[model samples]
Target: MTLRNSDFDEIRVWDNENFVHPWEGMEHIGQNERTFTETADGIYVTTEAGKRLIDGPAGMWCVQIGYGNGEIADAMATQARDMAYFSPFNNANSVPARLAHEIAKRTPGDLNHVFFTTGGSTAVDTAIRFVHFRNNILGRPEKKIVISRQKAYHGSTFLAASVSGKERDKGWLDQAQGMSYFLPNVNPYIRPEGMSLQAFLDEKVADLENAILEIGADKVAAFIAEPILASGGVIVPPKGYHKRCLDICRKYDVLYISDEVVTGWGRLGHWFASEDVFDIVPDIITTAKGLTSGYVPMGACIISDALIDSVSGEKSQGATFSNGYTYSGHPVSAIAALKNIEIFEREGILEHVREVSPLFQERLTALGDFPIVGDTRGMGLVGCVECVVDSNSEDSLDLDKTVGARIDHHCQELGLILRPIINMCVFSPPLIINVSQINQMFDIMEKGIKLTTEDLAVKGLWSA
Candidate 1:
């Protein structure tokens, strides 16, 4: 489907004039024409210019089942035709009710109650609100501080952004100050020199304890973390880190919120990584993205019965939670999520991810042999390749050169799309990608990195 030059020109002009892209340099982006994605199928996205590139970031770490899934599309259509929108505020809908039941059944521990939202940000925002609400109901209004680790990307909402630790993201943005605390991210690759993995884990846990003590546990509300930090360069913490953190949260009476926005669904070879992969049952689990496979905008904050029980019962006299979204349980989105989960079960996507993840990790780790490759780290199907000017000296990549962006440029030309996060190139392809596809992805990545290294060496920025 080749578009006419006039059609392309009109789209580019309209997009540049009207569309406000997220986390982008608007002026720079407007000056340089945007590459519009016309269509997508399987793992490949066809641009408006008709160039098909493999989607390496899985449509912002969402599209778990891949693209052009007719069944999901049909599900949305059927629901839309039947009943598209309905308020889930006080009123109940069948699809949302059933979907909530299905989600609750799959979630860990007694996280049996589902509160639906528009997307990951709202899901996180809702969870934080619930924490505040719970504490308020329990007469502990001072316990309102939410602790999050540095470099963690929660969401873009006011409360969610406040909890997020990405410094660059919060530059000009105003967050709810004093409402959130920061902890050091558990990046084992950059852990202090000579510290054993166990010691590093202990130090991270101790830092949380110290933060709680310093802030006074009575004033702390909840602690939120990702099982595997996805947007923060795919930083996978040391073994048993989550368990220790959960224990600390429990000891400090802080509600533990597992932000599985990127790690949920089949990304980590499980329905939810908090229990299956990390072995920790958090008080609240916030999920989005793969929940509906990016088919529709949806997210859910699953709360444990224990927390609900604490705030409920005869203690509160006729009190309501008093919060919800208009599209909280939109039938179309609910049906899409339902069919998405059905496809996961019928196709055994989790088993497939587990089967292919080792090879995926191995191929990615092999890129470390490249001269500019500093470190390669990942778990499940999500991974990252960090580039440095000097691996031995640990010198940072030159921002002027934009090493990751250069690699992305090469990769895109070689039939792949890569997410360049500063010096790190992150990969979270669709879970439906097979072994051959994984190899193809890595082959293009290696070529890109090699090309970038050669360019750097020519400019005397690096050496082989």
Candidate 2:
């Protein structure tokens, strides 16, 4: 089973020829270059070419407990041996049921009911569908408009993608645009030059309230928000922004859905960040990624008891919710999630995250020392470093696009892998990482940014 360097060459040819990747460009269908990961342990992944790099993005912000956890693998194997497949539609399984109970106890407020999905996209899709179903059952079919914020990333399913407001990701794809309304981007870094922080916060809150008022409260179903917009360069909104938005939603009778795919499972030093970090209990909370710590694929749309209560009972006997995936609540995935939670508790992973996050944030914010670094922001374990070529120049937009990739190239060479989003490089290393590793990661990152800055200056694309 050991793959040699030549084996990877063959694999790369096969990958380029047949395997389509996420966000694949049409021109690069058969010509794409990519790193082939051969194995992983702790916080590092070893490539097929024998390069070991810190998994900076933590396997797309999952892998909370880190790679190669024998415990998790053993749990998965045991679950598969007991029972692997079942129709959750009609039959119920104990694994997912137990996992559901485990999640319900951790989730804030009355979000006590859990519906399983294959991943984050389906989790969000289920949440949206549930909103529609709840509205329909309550005799308010017109209440179907889901409000989302610009730069927010929900997922890739039709319903999820439709509600996601990342402008760059929507250029070539079609989405159910009419089903959603988008609020303005809430990145505090992008606030108007002379505006005070309080003023900006007020304006951001007003955007939501105004959107609900303009759309009419009766038509607005929910306001879905990521506590920290993960994919949007780790944009942290103003303080009290989420709480105020929750109040607005409550005033307008709009449901609040906290999209916690990246924030949940100890990323924010809590099982759920909505109530713990932001002090807002959402009506629905969609989570995945760290749900199984990337050991297996799974996601969940947790429902408030109030919403479930309105639809259940003899009054609505035959009216079914009628939306789910065949692989919903897969036994192996559920067991994996259960084991992931167990590890989180047994190892006090949440406490570890809380202890080390201050250091993580401190080092992350220090990236702003670089001349080309436009902004650096994050909370808990996730962070983003944004680069700018020349904000005032006409060619800045075009030049900026390559900045992240250049930084990533240098970082990978220096034994770090970053998830570059246009001109931004994001970091969400394994929650299991220690302080020394944190220093090492940021040290390499700083060097990478310096190298990239030098490269930009040499090419005459940037000066500063």
Candidate 3:
């Protein structure tokens, strides 16, 4: 008879069958028992079966500073040994508080207050709620509609998904977000034949103005956007996009919320993309992922002085304002973030981004001649290759949904771990990567493209 251990006796078979995944991860769940992962190269991931896979997606774009840092680990252990947990209800740890001060010094504009969250999604939820409370405090309770561009991926939470620009994200969502007034984020591919990118952006701003009026400008509380639109196929905004956005937000008294959860850190070849590229001061900025470089989970919603002043004014903000997680401003996470920044500085991560960015563009764009490859675009370490059914028709590939997934699986078989977001195969390697590593990473991807294309052709997917 088999020995029935106490733990095993209570633990029965785990039923994960038929679990509907929130993202595009449902394709993998139906397979045999999941294979565990263990190691990571400078820009790759390894499975439990000893398959060496290039980490093309940078672990969902979080590990911007690469993986396996001894300093980050040490910092976490030291902080844990010193003080593990302290409730921020009244008492709090000095490490996170001081870290908050340091972060404020680094954020754009007069964003003097830093509110911590577990990740980007929660940080987004916090920013929206905070802005709503501020508007209510000012007696402009009617200002409630939060505007986001179409196809934006804010987060997966109920509130976050409600304000998100994606329709699919709202599939399982219930009820409206108590707000609407969404706008376009300037998709150049959709612009008129004669319209320039700048002109198209101008039209978008005009549309925003028109929408604000239609929604009753008083009903619009904030205008939220990503730095360059990370998840929405890495949509790169036209010149003067953020400037005009800031102008419109200021024009209608709508608060500016910049979701830099993917654009922050050295991913954009700068400390903060807002100042580094766009030159706009947002009222709120949400960041995560690279905060600790995936060594641990941590995020921040940096707040401006104007919003803080309104909420903590001569009286309460009227809204109970009782929203936030228990793990907010986690000490261990904060320490890890500090160490990550230190490593970033020591390694000169931003310089590395500046150096290899041009090379990355050259290599990725060279593959544009491939039959299915449509557009290759991105800035700094974050990029994407939008494989379409046919570039001439400009019609997106339906295979990108399934065949492209097979391509990713084929890549995994070749020891390349990459995540496909919507219609593009994204690339966000650790910032510490060298040029040789970048070449090899893309080489593996190019090979996967050829193999996947051949496989698709054999299955009658290719048509003249």
Candidate 4:
């Protein structure tokens, strides 16, 4: 379907004048026009110009069940017409209550209590607040520090952003000072020159322990982390990293909060990666993005029964946990999530991901053969291809050239949209992507990388 030129013009004018995009500079926005996605279906999205492009990042690492799921849309419509807006603050709602029970059944261990939030950021923020509230109830007000790993992307809210260790995201903003601390990221590709993977893992785990010790166990509230650092270039840690981290947190009496905003809901061939993939049950697991498959805005912080029980005692004076959003459990969003989970179970999306992920990883790993490709790392469906000037050297690509962006530009023209982060291009396509679609995506990526390499060579920036 073609939109009229006037329609496109009106949209462009309104967007340029009214829309304030995230993580974008106003100068850049004023200078360049944005590509408006008019429609999406399956694993692809069509732009206003009618160009179809593979959504390589799965719509910001969501959309696990893929796009254009009519069932989900119909569910939302039905719920909206039935009862759209309802307050979940000390009030019972059918859809949220039912969805919470369903979520509890799937989440690992005693993580049976679900606290709904607007999205991942709010979920993360709420989880931290709960930790603080729990500690306060236990008469340990000093235990307010949250230890987060470097390169971890928690969320955009004040507390969540404070917990996030991505320095660039915090440069211009003011974070909640002294509320969170950072540990070095576990990027296997950038581990010490001669250190073995086991040694690197040991050091990382030791760092967590050391940090907890330095902060005083009584002062540390929790440790939050992503199973695989998603937005931070898909940095997959060494084996047994998360399990060891959880052990350290438990030993230190620090609540373990798994930030599975990007890894949850079949992204990693499991409902939740903290237990199914990492073999550890965190005290709190924050999830969003894929919960409703991005059909609607929703997120949830699943709390362990142990934690909830501990904070439910009558020994201390009664205190109310007054933290909640107006739309904490919006009926429409709850119904959307319910339908999303239904699709997952009915279509066996997790099994499909498990079946296809090996091929996806294999295809992504093959890109490492390129001279500019420094590392290929990821698990399940999410992956990243890191580019460097010299594959054998430790030096990174020149920032001015924006090698990843160049590759992404070429890939976009070749029918694929990529998430370019510095020198790395990340891919987390919808779980429903087939082998043929996987091939098509990588083929376009390879061609884009080659074209980028040629452009670099022509500019005297690189050589094979």
The most accurate candidate by TM-score is: 2
lDDT of each residue in 78-117, candidate 4, tens digit only = 9889898986766788899999999999999999999999
Candidate 3 on 1-464: residue-level lDDT in tens? Answer: 33233332232223245444345445565443444456665666666555777677788788876667777778899999988777876677888898898788788889989889999889999998898777777788789888888878888776677778876666655836567556875667668889887789889888778888888888988888887777787888787888888898899898889999998988888778887788998999999998888888988899998777766746664556777788888899999888887778888888888989898888888767787777777888877777765434334445567556766777777667667765578778888778888888778788888887787688776653
Q: What is the lDDT of residue 234 in candidate 4?
A: 92
Residues 192-213 of candidate 2: C-alpha lDDT, one tens digit per residue: 8999999999999999999999
- What are the per-residue Cα lDDT tens digits for candidate 1 across 228-310? 88888899999999999999998989999999999999899999999999999999999999999998999999999999998
Better of 1 and 4 by lDDT: 1
The pairs that clash in candidate 1 are: none
- TM-score for candidate 3, please give it: 0.91
Question: Which residue pairs clash within candidate 3?
Answer: 44-55, 53-415, 54-416, 64-431
lDDT of 3: 0.78
Q: Which stretches of candidate 2 lie over 4 Å from their true place?
A: none
Count backbone clashes in candidate 1.
Answer: 0
lDDT of each: 0.91, 0.93, 0.78, 0.90
lDDT of 4 at 17: 78
Estimate the overall C-alpha local distance difference test score of candidate 2: 0.93
